[model samples]
Target: MPVTVHFAAGPAAWREYHDHLPRALADAGVQAEILLTAPDPAAVDYIVFAPSGEIQDFSPYVNCKAVLNLWAGVERIIGNTTLTQPLARMVDPAMTESMVEWVVGHTLRHHLGMDLHILNQDGVWRNEITPPIARERPVAVLGLGALGRAAGEALAALNFPVMGWSRTPKNISGIDCHSGDAGLAAVLSRAEIVILLVPLTAGTENLMNAERLARLPKGAVILNPGRGPLIDDAALLAALDRGHLGHATLDVFRNEPLPKGHPFWTHPRVTVTPHIAASTRPLTASAVVAENIRRGEAGEPLLYLVDRARGY
Candidate 1:
């Protein structure tokens, strides 16, 4: 008998992802039932889930081996007290590529001062305003995890003086990596462009408050493609208002769909995106989820397991 993998999601979800799931599972040397909805969670051996899916009670999934998340950030489902199943966050090559592209694109946009030249038709020829050699511009990336490390390395490959920081030390080739408070301060102080990639954990929540925001070189650009709560919006706005920060490119927010009246929408210096950075593409993500599910059933060590206490 093959693996009875369940995908308890909506009708549209099934239509979009059903074929891909089997293909991915087959590529991983496994087979699955791929049910659209989990009628009896207890009858399943493993589940592939989206946060918006109908099934919320993991308690009923008694025989389930693991609840493999199809999305990267598990903040929404992490709080479910009933979900004791080992939760895994998505880490696919496609996701890493998308994130690296976004980070590099935005970094170049700011580094070259494209906003000033592109947005202005005033025929103002800004001279010598572009970023110096990649080796000259200082970039500090918060969160040296897989995604962050990949992006940081990409930026360094461009010859940019890349500094990567995490809660703990991480050594990556061709990039300056640091940790602890001293590392944080050193990274923050000279970061002409700060790209935030930290996870939403106890140590990282509100990690970019006013004081920390002030630490950056004046008029520094802040780019966050990571968790929204990682930054204090009110404080960020104040930093922008105080003229300490030049611009903010935020892809995530404290609230989703970003309420119409939110300041970020109307704030001149802040660029609000509908969270397009590093989306978990279904075609690529199904394989990662399926691989983990296969590993779970085979009693192998699962990949990217969430730390419950840290809330990642």
Candidate 2:
């Protein structure tokens, strides 16, 4: 019997994944029927999910084996009481590569003080301030997930002293991994540049409060490609005002599209990017979804399965 897979990731996503997903399933040797709408939820063997979809309640999907997410972040849907099936988050290779590129590019920009020249075109030549090489700069990456690990390793490869931190202890070959309160303090204290890539979880919300931000060495830079609420907005602004921090290059925010007239837009020390860090490409993301479906059918362990208790 062919497994029934419903595309509940919305019309736009349907358009993006319609052809790619089916082709990926066929390539993975899965016989499945793809549906744009779930007229009969009970018959659905799997659901390709995104937060934008109409299916908020998953209780009706009695026979559903799993919910396969299209994007890497699962904070929006993880809190749903209706979701009971085993959930798998997307771990697209292309997305990981894009994140690593963004992190490295921005880290270099700040490390080399490129903005001092790029933003200023005046005739005055300021060659007195020379930037240090990559090895001399101590950097920290505050997450160890697929995205965080890749970014940290790339920085380490560049000879930037890389320290990685997580809520739970993690061991990565190139990264100087840290955990617990003391470990976090140790990583933050010496890091000349800090990059945040941690997931949005209860324990991590406002992870960089006033006290933690104050712990950073004076003139240290922050690169947040991770969750928005991880840093308290008021505390960050205050830190910048006090000159305790150098600058912040943010890719994500608590309020997306960041309303006009927001202080961050006008803040001299803050750089707000429109959440373009990484995106799931159909070619790679479809393969991840298809592989999970194959695993479900064959009773094999699914890839990137969500740990509900941890809220990632």
Candidate 3:
């Protein structure tokens, strides 16, 4: 029998994946029936899901082999008590490439003080302030996950000294890896520009609180393309207000479409991007989904499986 793959990632996603997914499944040699609505949930062999999807109860899909997430971050649905099936997170190459490009572009923007010239269009020549080259700038990446490692390596290639810290120790070829509380502090202290790409979890919520934010070298810039609650808003505003930190370029936030009254929107030192750092391109993302479905049928190990204990 062909596999019954239910596309439960929502209407917008359905529109994006409807065409690409079938082609990808064909390429992977998987015979699957893609369903937008499963009248008999128990018959579903797999589920392609997203946090915004309609299906909140996984108990109905008794025969489902695995739940394949459409996005990289799984914090939204990870704690669902009803979700018993094995889960896998998306790790699309196109998404990673987009993240690296955004990180590198902003890192260089802050490093070169492009804002100083761009914002100050007053006919005055600002050649007096010459920024140091990439080699002289020290950068730290707070997460060593796929996206983090990719961004760190890209910066490393540009001669920026890259230090990476993770929940546990990692040994990426180009990154100077660190782990544990002590390691985080060590990396934060020396970094002139710090990038936040850590996942959101109870232990990591408010990871950049006032105390930790203070550990950064004075005039340090922060690039947060990761989770929003990772940084404390009040503390960040305070740091920027006091001019202790150089600037913050934030792509994610605690409240997306950040409230009109929120200080971050008006804060001179803060750059608010509409969570556009990276996105799952349908063509590439569908292939990842297709590959996993193929593996599930072949009884091979599924790629990017999520460990519930780790809450990634």
> Estimated TM-score per prediction?
0.95, 0.99, 0.99
* Model 3 alpha-carbon miss at residue 158, Å: 0.2
Query: How would you encode candidate 2's per-residue C-alpha lDDT over 206-307 as one tens digit per residue?
Result: 999999999999999999988899999999999999999999999999998899989999999999999998989999999999999999999999999999
**What is residue 53's positional error in candidate 3, in angstroms?**
0.5
Model 3, span 34-88: residue lDDT tens: 9999999999999999999988999999999999999999999999999999999
lDDT minimum window of 10 residues, candidate 2? 10-19
Clashes of each: 1, 0, 0
Candidate 1 C-alpha lDDT tens digits along 1-312? 787778865666777787788898999888677766667777888887888887778898898888888777788888899998888888888989999999999999988888887888897777766557778789999998888999999999898999999987888998889999999999999999999998887678899999999999998999999989999999999999989999999999888989999999898899998899898777988888878877876889999999888777
lDDT of 1: 0.87
Best candidate, lDDT: 3
**lDDT of prediction 3:** 0.96
RMSD of each: 1.6, 0.8, 0.7
- After TM-score superposition, the amount by which residue 302's alpha carbon in candidate 1 deviates from its true location, in angstroms, is 1.6
Model 3 TM-score (2 dp):
0.99
Ranked by lDDT from best down, the candidates are 3, 2, 1
